[model samples]
Target: MKTLLESMAHGCARCMYCDDSRGTDIDHFQPLKLAPLRAFTWDNHLLACSFCNSNLKRDQYPVDAAGDCLLVDPTVDDPADHLYLLLRCGEYDSYSKKGEHTIRVFGLNRPDLVRGRRDAFCLACSKPRDWHNLRQAGDAEAGRLAQALFDSPFVDVVHAMHRLDPRRAEFVVGTHTLPALEHWQSVYGG
Candidate 1:
């Protein structure tokens, strides 16, 4: 139990499904009802929000027509391959079928989640520019901002916006000079 809690602490505490809410439940990535044999397996366990776990997801584990999982596994697949956030509208746009299915099943684009994500994005985008204006600030203040940015919810939204930067020469996040996003990589990484 201590080990499990430690892993959650060292990583993003946000729900894996919505990435907006607190991870209040340790969910079976493959539901126990559907795959009982794997109930106690660590790889099968994922931290999730109560809303995504008890409300939206319930026991549903969507599969493709051929019976393969349609949901993006945060531990395996890159979520960017499946889903990208529409920062302007605060909705997730699908780049793959898995993304569409995951969104439908977990209600990732629900109004409440969208609002939260939008707020996260706006602040993540604007705060860096603000910091740029206050260029004379010391490392101590910058450190505080970095801590706050990582502590903020729905940080993936910031990553999504960074991915779409006009000056993004590489497809990776290495170049986007958004303040405090470096803190995000240090914590819960993509």
Candidate 2:
């Protein structure tokens, strides 16, 4: 299994699936049953989440007329290039057929999930004092903020972002966690 740091750093950024929390199950981007030749290729391998790996995306490899996979592999390409996050509606808009399929398949705009993300973004923005003080505290202050987020119930949002968008999550967590990293035991895995 890929380490948390590795998953967060590479997997999340790449939007590749990684069932690190579960077992080390290597999945083909396109199912081996469907595309036997590409099955063993390194480009076809993706680390998947348990929900995506087992329940939803199991053996469901859709291909194009040329027999190429239709699914958007975040590792190879940027979903944002085709998909746009509708912050107001919490849905996704896409210009490509593959992007549309991916959003629908993954429920990228699930209402509750979208609302949760919006709320988290607002929360991070609302605390001006925390942010202002963070700059003055430097490393010591960053540790404190990290600790505060770790202990807070609101941290679930932070954790989810860590999995979904590591770069954004890391930025949020790093910026917010200033002055206190110890309090954020909820993240940083202690």
Candidate 3:
């Protein structure tokens, strides 16, 4: 078994295997059943969650012409750039083909994940002005944001929203999602 977790940490964005339970496995990115030629090729390997590798994806490698992927590669591209977490409905919407494909392929809007992302979004939006102030203060905003994100119960929401809707970025920080804001304010020091 290759050290797929290490490879993913270096390359895959938010590589799911980074939070492995039983260590990582060498997942064939394209699926060995679909692209047997690459069954053992290093380039075809990736570190994936058992959920992503087994129950959800399996050997299903859907692609478009030029053999490009229709799904998100947490390795090659940022999932946040294309996918968004819906605050009210907890569904995912996409602004681009890549995002659409990823959402469909990975079931990014699955009810459990949707709920989780919405909670994460709530945490992100609860303290919007602080983020703005941090930005104005020139205080390594990226690091602050990253820390705030993990600390927030709604951090997953921020990541999911960033993935689905970079174009209408305000949804993550808008007032329409006030329930999340209230929750954060009451519990998370917002």
Candidate 4:
């Protein structure tokens, strides 16, 4: 079960919530305490880091006034629809109550996570250039670099870069890196 959950996770089995640390816990998306009947349900399981599973979100589920769960379920919900990442600073801005709740419950804006995301943003910006150069030079390591880029922590940053509009992406990632990013997106379908 753990192996299956890990396989389902993104970027070397990174935590589904934080996306910065290895997923070490089988998180009950709907906590077992809150929904004991769903204890053994397959869809309830999510890969999470210790900090996110134990320290942060442990059994704490919030609901809207209408009794809808406020947390963003990564399996069923697209987080990008609710939370937007600021490419410049690695901070997340929530456009919905669910996003706001998830950010608070998961500590998405914690100092360490923010720093990690910022660093990852820089790496995501630079890796495309490196990959392009390596490919042009016919370097054997180009494939490895491409794989590493996909497997790196904070893969959300990479995907966000790809999702940026033409002018904004070019402005943020720079002209040279934008084409490479687009090439990677075309090839890798991120």
Candidate 5:
């Protein structure tokens, strides 16, 4: 637990599956009962929320027709490749079979989670949207807002908004000239 916390700077690092809640438990990706040999292995462990660990996941690890895990490892895979964020509704539109399974199994689009994500995205975007009023502010102000977005709860939701076209991301920005908007573009526009 200490190792996991230290690695993520004690911020819960968000749930590995849902990318929302603070990870609250040490979950064995491969259940100990299913893979006893790896019980003490490092790679086999990941941080998860109690809800995911005990309720949503609960020792259920699905496998493909070839017996490969359907779950995507955050350390080994790019989640965005399988899932795309819906900016307006704050839901996910899956692009793969694994993505669908991951979303269903983890309740990734649960109403509460979607609402929370929407709220976070809106709050983070407000910083850039209000940049006109911040022209006289110190250079570090914009950086601080961006940092706050990264450190705040539901960061995955906040970061996901950056994947959209700037004009489509109404909360973020529609035009240039705002330092906050520029900072967002510089960091995530690529």
Candidate 6:
């Protein structure tokens, strides 16, 4: 079960919630105590880090006024629909109740995670230009660089950048890097 959950995780099997640490815990998205009937259910399992599963979320499950789960299930939902990353600060802003709840439960804005996102964003912004340079020079290493960029930690940052409007993306990554980013997005499908 743990193996299966890990296989479902994104970017080198990172934690589904934080997308930072390795997913070492087989977390029950719906805690066994709250949903005992789902104990053996595959869809109820998720890959999580120790910090997210044990320290933060634990067995708590918050629901909205409508009784719908407030947590964002990465496997079943598009997190971008609820949460948006602020490129300047590496913090996430919530546009939905579920996003807000999930941020609180997962500590998405924790200092370490914020720093990681910021660092990853900077690196992501730079890598496209590097790839472009390598490709322009006809270097064989371009593919490897592209793969590493895609597999980097905090990959959600890159995805968010891709989802940005052209003007905003150009502003965030700068005009020089924007074209390279767009080229990579076109080739990689973001």
**Candidate 5's C-alpha lDDT?**
0.70
For candidate 6, lDDT tens digit of each residue in 58-81? 998998788789999877899998
lDDT of 1 by residue, 124-180 (tens): 766655444444454456556656666678877667755664454133323444444
Model 2 misplaced stretches (Cα beyond 4 Å): 1-25, 124-129, 136-140, 143-190
lDDT for position 85 in model 6: 97
Q: Estimate every model's Cα lDDT from 0 to 1.
A: 0.72, 0.52, 0.58, 0.89, 0.70, 0.88
Task: Indicate which candidate wins on TM-score.
Answer: 6
Scored against the true structure, residue 179 in model 1 reaches a CA lDDT of 44
Taking the tens digit of each residue's C-alpha lDDT, what string does model 5 give over 11-91? 446667776777778888888889999887877778888898899988787898899888766667788888877755788
lDDT of 2: 0.52
* Tens-digit per-residue lDDT, 60-119, candidate 4: 999988988999998889999999998879989898999999999999999998999899
Window of ten residues with lowest summed lDDT in model 2: 11-20
The candidates, ranked best first by TM-score, are: 6, 4, 5, 1, 3, 2
4 against 5, candidate with superior TM-score: 4
